[model samples]
Target: MILLRSGAFFPLIVMSLAFASLVLASLVTGAANVSFEDLLLDPEGSSLLLVSRLPRTLAALLAGASLAVAGVIMQMLVRNRFVEPATTGTGECAALGLLATTLLMQNSSILAKMAVSSVTAFAGSAVFLTLAHRLPPTQPLLVPLAGIIYGGVIGALTNFIAYEFDLLQYISVWMNGEFSGVMQGRYELLWASGVLAVGAYLYADRFTIAGFGKETATGLGLNYKSVVVLGLAIVSLITSFTVLTVGIVPFVGLVVPNIIRRFKGDNVRATLPLVALTGGCLVLASDLIGRLINHPYEIPASTVFGIVGTCVFLWLLYARPQRRV
Candidate 1:
């Protein structure tokens, strides 16, 4: 009951309501009826709800929370507000790893794909951060822009390789974040993202200090490098898990954490759950809106979120005027 008295309670209540509403809507909006009543009275609806609808809802929630927590860790690690797996070449690198595994082993297990992707993602993130610090740091936008370009190059290379191997169609299926294809057996891997989210909560204070940069962190008796590596590992695992389970969902990471940071002022532990809830809610809302707009045939959650995220990104970038030379 003390939770109800806490400052976080009201926001939690609002977010929980939103989350519940979205879950309910998603449960019922598919090709068949999956209402609560159907769960009790109709075996078919019960089966569908259990195997498909429930799993998809959980996937969205897990993916959203993982990515958002990852975004928070990343921004703190690099001290850059705008970087995310999609922008920072992490997703592209993971995709590249996926393609490589497909070509090399052809029938590799999902775990193999995840392992390769996580390795490549760690390397990619390392390169981005190294390059980011090497460049003149006059402009804050420099790092994100570079990361976007790098990710684009990686993406283009991935596409070329896919085209050569006649794997473009398969690659396309995994490039975008879409929940339409989610079913129980396929989505259980996303549970790893939930575990990673909890880990983020545990390391929240360390990341908070690391964001102050090496000198300050070292001064405070912290091993900055270890903290960053742990953070990167978390991000990599989260990214690879999502890609393997539901393809790459962009912007949930980039947008949700930034909004929370702006309003809550970077108290990650306190805001961690909020970031997770808001991110999941945003993706859930996107999925719901897509379901309603097209009815039986639905748009990908990625497409809807892409639009929403792009708008929020623009606002964050240019909402306030900047003085240029």
Candidate 2:
């Protein structure tokens, strides 16, 4: 494996430049006739750019970065490289929360829905962690397999409830991640997820320590439980916000961080920024490809990433070395 040490200046520069290029591509690649001239000269006059393109691009970037960070946080806390928020019932529980809010408080505001989703997501994550603790530590791969099954059950429940109430369409919006509907006013809530991702960086050292196991971290004077709670909160809130805004973009959290950790190592403080940028680049590039692949018709970013993520996941599962969590 090629190990690139974290905090390297060159990698950051390259990733930043690639991210910028993807953002520009996302801004201009749509059904509307937006040009570099229109972007540079009449930036505000183009309703498509102002109303749709910019918002969608921002949403993609925010969701990607936040989810990738959340994934890193999850892997750190769970000590399982394969685990992520989506696999561990967090996203499914968020969908359940959204479904409940839609059914009960049909007139509730978006913030209200997000609050409910965050609570449910947190509760679900806590449950998963409890189950994880019960699993034999020697079987490292079992954690992710259990998480996938746990998430599947919650997702099945959410789907059944949504189908019963004729809200499958509503639930599907959160189940699948996409950015086509994002407009200026509709996507600002994702900024909170971006903030929370940054917040996670502040506690990166604690998380890295926590990954060494509760006893070790506690022996070293870390507040193990407090750090776990904080990590769960960050993961849940980020998941809720992204799910509500752009749907659940699967494999972002699963694929991006593992790829980073594989080469960059797990120094959260040094590698966190690169993980966030690479994630944003992945989602924005996926979004742009989805838009251009079908021309006037668009594929969801989730679909594009699903194919890519699955391939990478298989490669990781078979080709890479596994570590005990």
Candidate 3:
């Protein structure tokens, strides 16, 4: 009847086990190796697990699921599978908002900063949507091209301002995706994305319907404009919380949903969980690989995903099979 009918569930079972193993690997790897036995005998290992490892894993899962769903919603709303918060101007606008607050309100709490960033994100995404709406929909490649240029312009402006004000170091920290510094109290805000994912799931059908165009959705008793706005709001919140907590990571949203959609069709209602699960798995795997690649030192998740996701995205664009079973 749906994606579940095609034996997708088996792959999900396999992915779930893989995800569990990765989570364990995250909890176990690091400068201070942790084991289950350490929980009973080694106080230092226990503290490391509790304070750093667990929080880092939670942050990756939350960000992954949040961004994956956010990407699906964006692609559906814009009718382009390549668009995302990073490719659009959402993350840049958020970084700009944080920079503004740093200069203007030195005493602002992180939550307040996130509020400002969300507003900026909404504005930036609105601009991208407007511009995307102007593009020729027949050429899908043009959509992400315009988005990347748009994001680049915004990001460059933010960087220029950062340099002028000597905030480059702080902006640098806010612009890269890394899990090395995530710890208790710091990474908890990432769960906001997880909560929003639940709402995204409930509205999955509406977003999917909207992708078929306004007339189709309207004929089906859907409020197309409202759905778009709601989707953008959800994306804004996810983008804000994610960038505010862990800097910006690219392609999780763009890559994961597209990968799942290839097999599951466009039925987001049936595929949303897989999207979330796969997103979480990819990010967790990236973080784990980053830890091991450089040994006692570390690479950022962005570095790993940048190389890997770019290759996968290219393959999807070019080498993707001409036929699907």
Cα error, residue 61 of model 1, in Å, equals 0.6
What is the lDDT, from 0 to 100, of the residue 137 in candidate 2?
90
How much is 145 displaced in model 2, in angstroms?
A: 1.1
- In model 2, state the lDDT of residue 37: 71
lDDT for 34 in candidate 1 is 60
Clash count list over all predictions: 0, 0, 0
- Clashes, model 2: 0
The full ranking of all candidates by lDDT, starting with the best, is: 2, 3, 1
Candidate 1 displacement at residue 142 in angstroms:
0.8
Estimate, for each residue in 43-107, the C-alpha lDDT of model 1 and write its tens digit: 88788888988898999888888899988998888788888888899888888889999999888
Clashing pairs in 3: none
Tell me how candidate 2 scores on lDDT.
0.91
Cα TM-score of candidate 1: 0.95
Q: lDDT of all the models against the reference?
A: 0.87, 0.91, 0.89
Question: After aligning candidate 3 to the native by TM-score, how far in Å is the CA of 305 from where it should be?
Answer: 0.8
